[model samples]
Every structure is written in C-alpha cells, then in structure tokens.
Target: MRGLDDHTYRKRTAALKAKRHDCWLCGDPIDYTLPWKHKMAFTADHIQPRSKGGHIYGEIRAAHRSCNSSRSNRVTTVTTAPKTALRW
Candidate 1:
C-alpha cells in the first residue's frame, strides 16, 4: 500500500515529536531529530498491520525504526535475530 507523502509524513512526525512520544514497543523516547534511516529515528507505526488494511494515524503510534521492523506484520513479541537482532 501507498504510504504518507513526504509533506504529510513530515507534519505528522513533527506533531508526534512535539508531544514527546515514546516508542510503543520498547518504552524508549522517539528521537525526531534523527533521520528516518537511523535505527533510533521516529517512525509512524500501525497498531494493526497495514497489509490488513490499517491506516496511518488510525491505529498508529510512534516507534523506533528498528522496533517497528522487528515487529512487522505480527502481533508477536519483538525478537532479536541471532546475528543482528534485526529482520533485515
């Protein structure tokens, strides 16, 4: 599915940062100052999987990129890969 545009992404991310949101996965604070590619960067996450028709900000929360990737498309607890602790 298509994701939020850059403009919308920026606006929404900024708003969450303004609210000082913490990572929904690990209870860590989101560092909005970091770029999205950073492991600790703030990302918009769906409480439900988007592939299951979830919408941004519908059931969304802020998460770290690593945290979100680690949680992708599942309701399972976050797990670390043996080598990297990341799915990638």
Candidate 2:
C-alpha cells in the first residue's frame, strides 16, 4: 500500500497538532520539533482498534511512542467510587 509523502505528512501533522494540544491518551504535552529530532517521533493511535471496526484517521489520539505502545488496543475508562469511612 502507498504511504503519505513527507510533505503531506507534515501538513497533516500540523493540522492535528493545531486541533489537539496534547497526547490524547495521557494528556501529556506534545513537543513540536524538527523531523530529525529524536522526540519528533509520535504515533497516531486508534481510540478503538481497527479490528473492532475502527477506521484509518478515524477517532485517533496522538501519543509518545512509549505511551502508545503501552496502551496498545486497550479500552481505557475512569470510574468513581463512593467515599467510605475507614477504621484504624
């Protein structure tokens, strides 16, 4: 399959950066850098895996390489519990 050229990738990356200011998964700040910089490597992750009917460029989140890898294909959610008194 054909992949996006460097120019097209840059444009798309810039637009996505403008829309979301941080890593969508962990809420970490995104570092904008030159293409050659080591920190420039970022992954576009699917909020829901493609195997589960997710589409390319559909519901994506930008994340650091490590964070993206660690979060691979898992559904994340935040839950709250009622407060209870504790006994010593």
Among the numbered candidates, top lDDT falls to 1
Predict model 1's lDDT versus the native: 0.74
lDDT of 1 by residue, 55-83 (tens): 55455678899999998897644464222
Candidate 2, 1-88: lDDT as tens digits: 1366555555666676666456666666667553423443466666787767765555665666567778767775525432235754
Q: Looking at candidate 2, what is the lDDT of residue 77?
A: 52
lDDT for residue 46 in candidate 1, whole number 0-100: 73
- Tell me which residue pairs clash in candidate 2: none
Residue 86 lDDT, candidate 2, scale 0-100? 75
Candidate 2, position 34, lDDT: 30
Give the TM-score of each candidate. 0.66, 0.56
Off by over 4 Å in 2: 1-14, 18-20, 34-40, 78-88
Task: Enumerate residue pairs that collide in model 1.
Answer: 81-85
